[model samples]
Target: MAVNLQKGQKISLEKEAGGALSRVTMGLGWDVAKSGGFFGFGAKSQAVDLDASVVMFDESNRPVDVVWFRQLKSRDGSITHTGDNRTGAGDGDDEQIVVDLRTVPESVRSLVFTVNSFTGQNFSTVQNAFCRLFDTSNGKEIARYDLSVQGSHTAQIMAKLYRHNGEWKMHAIGENGSGRTFDDLMPLIVPHL
Candidate 1:
């Protein structure tokens, strides 16, 4: 079953499985604010100073994995202060999260992805956020969740994996607040599990 996530919550993916997941993939997508106008008018704006990441934790909720940790750049080479569109404008800003679930400690139980303002003061708003979990054994999407804007500049989204009645389950969590770095996300993550 899929879990309903509120803004600013984290869900553990490996709670009662008795071991770590074999493989996991996570993806996030969002719309950037348009540029050249006072209210998203005129020219299309880019999210230049955006930072996205996915962190994995053990059953004990310890740090285990990190992915997509960097500042985004424009792929088309258009330098008008607009942000980079990696997959073209039509696809939106999409990032992937892949984790070798087998490598995660058996004590760990979940994974988290926190989006933030990377350029200090630029691109502080999160227009939209979505996440999907995939099973590596067969490259299948097991579950998905759409993040709701909680009026915060940053958000800590979580996905938990566990076994229920002989079937695996994923729970998604959406937490709000400004968490630009991994250290900032730790505090918000520990208590959620």
Candidate 2:
């Protein structure tokens, strides 16, 4: 079952129902640049610095491992080195992060994504951020969340996983700011885990 997510929502997964074989996949998406321009026309283009990551945590919310991390660019969704921006500047663009839960420790109960920088001088205003969970067993989407509610800012976006009764649950959070490190994101996400 694919979880349909809206902005400012959260879900959790329970182990009692799915057992150890349960796997979850999370995806983040956003429009990097706007057609009108960055903060409007005649302004410096902002490039998404594109630092994406997934941190696995146990029930206790302790750091487990980094499941996936990358800096992305306009590559037609291909996983290759398109490039990186020291400053957040550019036209409208799309960037994403993909995480496969199977590779991480089974104890992991949640995942979080943080934007390190908008590198390009113009692209710093993030339009959207989101995460989704997929059922690896059937290759179906279990749940999804859209984080576009917090428009035009840099911050940490988080998704939580835990079991409620016998089903998995997830929670989506959008933290706003720039220069905030990944470590700063943990506290906002830990409560949901």
Best candidate (score: lDDT)? 1
Off by over 4 Å in 1: 1-22, 35-41, 64-93, 120-124, 136-139, 148-150, 162-168
Cα lDDT for residue 116, model 2? 51
After superposition, the stretches of candidate 2 with alpha carbons farther than 4 Å from their true spots are: 1-3, 12-23, 35-44, 68-104, 118-124, 135-139, 150-152, 163-167, 177-180
- State the lDDT of candidate 2 residue by residue for 51-98, as single tens digits: 555565667878766533343421222122223334333332233344
Per-prediction TM-score: 0.61, 0.59
Going through the candidates in order, what is the number of backbone clashes in each?
A: 22, 45
Worst 10 residues of 1 by lDDT: 73-82
Error of 1 at 104 (Å): 2.9
